[model samples]
Target: GAGWPGLIEAYRDRVDIPDGARVVTLQEGNTPLVAAPHLSELTGCTVYLKVEGANPTGSFKDRGMTVAITHSLAEGSKAVICASTGNTSASAAAYAARAGLTSAVLVPQGKIALGKLAQAVVHGAKILQVQGNFDDCLELARKTAAEHPVTLVNSVNPVRLEGQKTASFEICDVLGRAPDVHCLPVGNAGNITAYWKGYTEYHGDGLVEQLPRMFGFQAAGAAPLVHGHPVAEPETVATAIRVGSPASWENAVKAKDASGGLFSAVTDEEILSAYRTLASREGVFVEPASASSVAGLLATAADGRLPTGSTVVCTVTGNGLKDPDTALAGMVEVEPLPVDPGAVASALELR
Candidate 1:
């Protein structure tokens, strides 16, 4: 067996897949769980970053899209549809192209990051920018898929979670056990729900002796779970997480309750600070929404709420390149240097 089999091949003996199905893969799993020394020192807790941006499509959504598209092809579906902030569409479009199925993506108008948008478009997806929020796009996608002969590849599809759950398996395999705590940026809430399910299944089957407490964080302006009500006009600089309502709301709550975890909110300012910190301090660059977990971690640490010396893993969901606009706004530009070596030395103050 060659090393680095895709998730389906890697876990085929453990989980269910379509019978006799050819593995459709972009090698979406087996991301690095890099240690975050600075974060660990600051919080007095051991922290590791689940660098999901290393996935083929530059986001964790590739995990779900792989399974969803594979299942759709096996089921003889000629087309697939999904609603996404950005990453989901890109993944779906790419996979659909591979599977020889049509893909359609519905997105919120003028909201998604340009990099993600470029992926979906280049992959030949039929993109619809609805003049509404993510919730509205999701609703329309579901309705369209139901009324037509198309399969919806959103996280609402069980096959997507089946693929995504493998992330937990990888983590457990690497750690030799589950960490004491797992943190994530919650948008549609499906990720938190899927992770809790994974940990529970592994523990039940004796793969793990313990399970991590699921700590979910959301943008303050779009924190439906934290507020106990959906915000009609959710707004945040973390465009990936600008969801007013979560599809997996009840399941997310269940994960929190079952794991003795809590849902929390982080402001845009805090998210940006964590974004900058991850890049400058830890040399890990991630999108603004992906930094929400780190921001929440620091917030809890500052308030003396985090348990000291505990092992923790934060899922960074997307690449920083996905949202260059947020990373560049208000940053100082470096002036071009002259060709002369002396000019370069002068600019560096080495003279």
Candidate 2:
């Protein structure tokens, strides 16, 4: 009640919501722009992390879900649907529950992380395990929505981008100007597209004097943007970003071209390395897909593509807790310690 209003209320004038529409929200915006001193030192740039994991649904999807569900409710829709690898389903399920609408999520069979699947199930969403990839699931959802009375809440919906653009506004608002470079994982490519729109709108409004170069990263196994074509079978450890055909392909490419940025693919090993670095070195635990941003930053900086002393912001898109399977991977197995302080100290090597 006495905290940060939701994004729509915070940027009511900027966002395009129908007049008199009842806003559906869960206080999903105003995520922290955390300083990354370790990343800064390593890259020789002023680095910050836009921690979207702090959102209501433990991912950036909540930002868009709010708007999509709100619009669905206003249009008198009793149900919402989407296709997701993980995060979008969780967010849509939650927002739909809040809006008192039935939610249906189409996901690839046996592909989604359990934590995210648990969220959708717990939120009462009808989970359909499609025997296909993410792109196929999306196509099915689109067709179903087109045939039925259900509203599709995917990034293909325009209102979703409107809500997502607020992240860029928050970054600019906190820093008092745009960063020199903004890096983020590009899955369906909606985020990069939305962020580019936000940054350009701010520049047009004279809110900031300059625009940042948009750096979009993808998992090497699923990098259609880098390959200049879609892959038939995308494979990656980072399930959240294992999408071969991005829905916002054209806009994402336009964003990169307009901002003079580049798209590169990071291997799963590189992604995991950055993931561990964020957790162990920087005390910021994020999902593996989120680490693609930091991995890209490190790759670019090491190759001298990122200039020293530049200001950079990397968006970590989802919470590590969203993928417990990946988090527990390679966990050390140890014998049960005796119930004594000495045993703990011995394990910690502090004695």
Clashes of each: 0, 0
Residue range 1-351, candidate 1, lDDT tens digits:
367877888888765768987667887899999999999999999999999999989998988888888888888899999999999999999999988889999999999999999999999999999999999999999999989999999999977888888889999999999999999999999889888988999999999999998999999999999999988989999999999989999999999999998899999999999999999999999999999999999998888667998899999999999998998899888889878999888988997
Best by TM-score: 2
The lDDT for every candidate, in the order shown, is 0.92, 0.96
Can you give the lDDT of residue 5 in candidate 2? 85
**lDDT of each residue in 46-97, candidate 2, tens digit only:** 9999999999989999999999999999899999999999999999999999
What local lDDT score does residue 187 receive in model 1, on the 0 to 100 scale?
A: 95
The true-versus-predicted C-alpha distance at residue 292 of model 2, in Å, is: 0.1
- Give candidate 2 misplaced runs (Cα > 4 Å): none
Q: Candidate 2: TM-score?
A: 0.99
> Which candidate number maximizes lDDT?
2
